[model samples]
Target: MKRKTIIVLVAAVAVALTLVAFYANSGIQSPKQEEKFRIAKVVRRDLGASVQATGIVKAMVGAEVKVGARTPGKVVNLPINVGDRVEQGQVIATIEQDDLIARVRLQEAILAEVKAEHSRLAKDFERDKQLHETKSISVQRYDLTEALHEIARARVLKAQAELDVAKAQLSYATVVAPIKGTVASVNTVQGETVTTGLTAPTFIKIIDLDRLEVLAYVDENDVGNVKVGQEASFTVAAHPSTDFKGRITSIYPSATIQDNVVYYLTSVSVDNREGKLMPDMTANVSIFLDRRKGVLTVPNQTVQREGSKKYVYVLHNETSEKRYVSTGWKDSSYTEILDGLKDGETVTIGDPGRK
Candidate 1:
């Protein structure tokens, strides 16, 4: 019985040792399981040095025109509404012409009567001159006939002027488009009374959508980077995924202030042959100052600047080392590396201090 107890005690001791060895192995971590290092590789990419700005799309100068009435009358006919396409010389609106027509008829009748009287006086004056030459009439009577003819001729001319004035007034009642464009706004409706006083009443506003342009307000600090003929791209809220391309056509010489910040207005000429772009749409623009193809670049966050010197941490074989680099132009998220870094080199970031 004692021999059996000794065998059982040895088995119990072996089991305890096995449990302790298993726990010891599980509690310890290998060197590979220690703090891990995050790394990124130097990449070759096409980088664009650009200035970002927010601007509004507008119609180019002379692309928009306001159509107005020149005479005061009730709007009798408005054939076009907003968004209607119009051609040059197309009748857009017409005012009440009954009064103007009657005035024109009255002036015509006055002109006709004056012309008849002048013709009769001219004939009588010639006959009286013959009688005076033949001593058949007195000189004063001949002179009186000549004076009457002159007075009648002047009245005829005056009446003709009045008739021309009346005709011009009648023509003013009709409003025609000055250019070919789309009607953007209609300020008057049929039967609305419009007056032509100091200022002509606007009947419709037209815009040439084919000549749409983007007006980008660049910050004053960045205005110097923008120049004419530089390539740019923009995205509108209506077409967020679609990018429209243009070039800087002009830059306003004057500066505009908004909330104490100065901005320069830049005009970008966009191609709207497809007619997808519209006026007054907000455009997020990027003007490319420079573009480099297949250049080595690094994440901006990986670079640390001390004075004029810039450097990044490079990782190799489980070790982190400081590498001073020379940088070129940089965009918002990346920096262009001019030198001191090779392609495929691992850039270490977010690691503890390595001395």
Candidate 2:
């Protein structure tokens, strides 16, 4: 009987510990605590809609050129280096021209001898023609002399043409800058052999830095909204905070395809008077589409699209109410409210107490 009494007291102590643990877990929250929400009041403000795209800075068309050698020769002189400024008609490089000069002199001598022979043949032809008219010589002999005179005249013409060609080939030994620009690259150096055949070897590259432009590849959908003369602003990675302004100058007709998606190349004329931007630098561009003034606006996150319909949450007297809203122009951050919402009206932005 004493053992049974001891067992009953231990079972009562275990039951009391179980009841205390259950009450400790349930006492954290009370039924009177109210649910909280994040709310924002609608306001009127000016909003600008913009299309974003990435592009590379480039020199204008015809402003950049790859200078090449016109004839095969050993490079004897390279007067310019990378980043050197050159003007039109300036000799940037020269090839070994000793052989070319000798060829020119040889052709000149040949042309002179041919011209002297032609002069003598012409006088003989005149005398032979007079003798034939007076019956002083045979008709066959006069015909022979006439043929010899014509052959001499042809030789003179051929020699003159050869001389001109030789002079032209000699001129090719000197490479000149075709346009006024800065030398962006030097592909060849002194003593390098350049062989010109089907394609001339490139010697240098000159580009006009003053005429800088940006080629922005806008997506196919957003390209329709972009037009010539539209104002655009861009920032490069080197100067992220500084905004450069430009205007749309052209839109290429061809579409560039990548991964089955199409993009149109648009050209923007950038003003680089300060000379800070460099070629091949990437630019993040924003093309302004339109600006709406004094429009009722709300945070873009507040509105949610349900298929073709859009709706938002409205806070009325501490109760969350779902209401449909008609929207107009929208930007990256805010959306224009056309109807179903007024200025200074409270709207629920997000669910509270949820992370």
Candidate 3:
């Protein structure tokens, strides 16, 4: 045995130097394992800065009214239908009032036959003015009895103006409801015979669902930062998880193109007193402008712009640095830092040329 093969060739060269020193210490790394970066902190709170229109919900200028039939007739007592609700004077429909109560009783019998011929021509003009002052009346029979007492006082003022135009055409056969709404549409049915001509044919269309309003359109490059009272919010499509709050009362100075894009209608208001909002529906607005309470924020993907200048990195004790900030108001995940950043400073969240 040549000394047992030199002790097994020195244990096979000590197991190939312990497998090349454990693969060169696992291919070197350490420094907290090459830091893998991804941090945040520099915060403080509150931030707003919005403006994203696209609305509809309308109905707020006299809140949709309509109601028609100013005299024609026939629908006789149509009570009310389409969603009813009414109130402001109620009635809602009832035309053919027996030929408007026979023209208000034929103008109250021609105003009681012209007030009984004006009380018999005022008693024959006071007995010919006392027989024409005792001269035995003969000044052409006292000027024809003072022109027959001024033609019976002009036939009692034309029969009291034809009995006040037959009591205003019998109060236009009652149709009422000038507001306080919800009816929406009726157009006639009970006996259907509506006919008015110069416009009063609507018959019903109320609507005041708590006076809604949203309209929003915007986008004339953000309608110059939309302002009127500011602060707003919306979201409808039939209450899509409800958000509805409002303010920006108006802005439409005209400009609404479409397909070529132009917009600018604004408005906003809406409270809808919990009626769940309606009319046209479709909102999705925002508005909010500028608000930055507490300040010192960060996270908007850790800033980092470069052309118009804007930066951030600062991680310290572990390394990162860069910095350069001076933001203001961003929202949608923070930004508003204003100066080089400090609050709790830590920043550094991704692609700084990704390791």
Candidate 4:
């Protein structure tokens, strides 16, 4: 009976030790309290921070031309069409010059007739002046001839000036390109009479293709971050595959506030020499301000606050170790490890089995 009791006790002790070893190996301390930590791997990507904004592409040198005749006339001819390339002095359209020519001729004829009359009157007036002094002519007759001569001379001068102006108006009737650019559009066709009454008619629009600008409307909250000379990259929907890169050229000081929201117009410089980017193309812009390269970094999730100090867990030889670290500029993913860390260090983070 004694031997049997001792055997039973030893068997019971062995069973208890086996249960304890299994429990320790399974990593189940308690069932009530379970926790999990998200983990991330430190990566190397060009960190870019930007205030995103929707913008439109605009031509650097764009002009709408009001090239109709300064004086109203019928459209005689339009040599250029939409999309036609024109030189600076090349004629694009012609207006009816017949009326101007007729008026100029009439004025010139009138000037000639008045000048002939003035010459004869001047000779007679000079004789009249001499005769009046010599008592050969009456004072009233001499004064009257002298006044007629002066009035005829003034009329001749006025007619000559009118003739010159009429000829000049005829020259202005031929509309010409003021800039070297592609004609965006032609408003009126040949034989279409555009009324030049009061306001001048816009005949064509010319846009220079070498240079371009990106007009971005930045929200009031992000406007403070926008500054001149910030590097930026953008892509337009028209050419979605191509990236248009530029620098912030300007920030409008005045804010456009409406409906309790405010925004400012920001302009950036772009190159469109390839002519792929047209005016009014929508742009997706990203402004890059700061970056870090090849520096010691940790997953931002590992950063925990212990009282007032920042801490990160380090794994060394099957033991969990925590170290205090200093951090610097951080993005949404990684925090810059400024101090208290080095490259290639293993950090313990995340759940081993929880969830």
Model 3 segments beyond 4 Å from truth? 1-48, 51-58, 66-92, 119-123, 126-162, 169-171, 174-205, 208-212, 215-226, 229-235, 238-247, 250-277, 280-284, 288-296, 299-330, 333-355
Write down the TM-score for model 3.
Answer: 0.40
Question: Model 2, residue 176: displacement in angstroms?
Answer: 1.2
Per-candidate Cα RMSD to the true structure, in Å, reads 10.2, 10.4, 14.9, 12.4
Candidate lDDT (C-alpha), each: 0.86, 0.86, 0.80, 0.75
lDDT score, candidate 4? 0.75
lDDT of each residue in 30-108, candidate 4, tens digit only: 3322222333334444544466677888876443344555667778888888788788899888889888888888988
lDDT of 1 by residue, 192-305 (tens): 999876576676899989878999998765687789999999999999999899999999999988766788999998998888888999999988888778889888788885
Per-residue CA lDDT of candidate 2, range 146-213, in tens? Answer: 99999999999899899998898899899899999889999888999887866766779999888999
Give model 4 RMSD, 1 decimal.
Answer: 12.4
Show where candidate 1 strays beyond 4 Å: 1-47, 122-150, 199-201, 292-355
Instruction: Compare the candidates by TM-score and give the number of the best one.
Output: 2
Ranked by TM-score from best down, the candidates are: 2, 1, 4, 3
Worst 10 residues of 1 by lDDT: 29-38
User: How far does residue 197 in candidate 3 sit from its true spot (Å)?
Assistant: 28
Instruction: Name the candidate, 1 or 4, with the larger TM-score value.
Output: 1
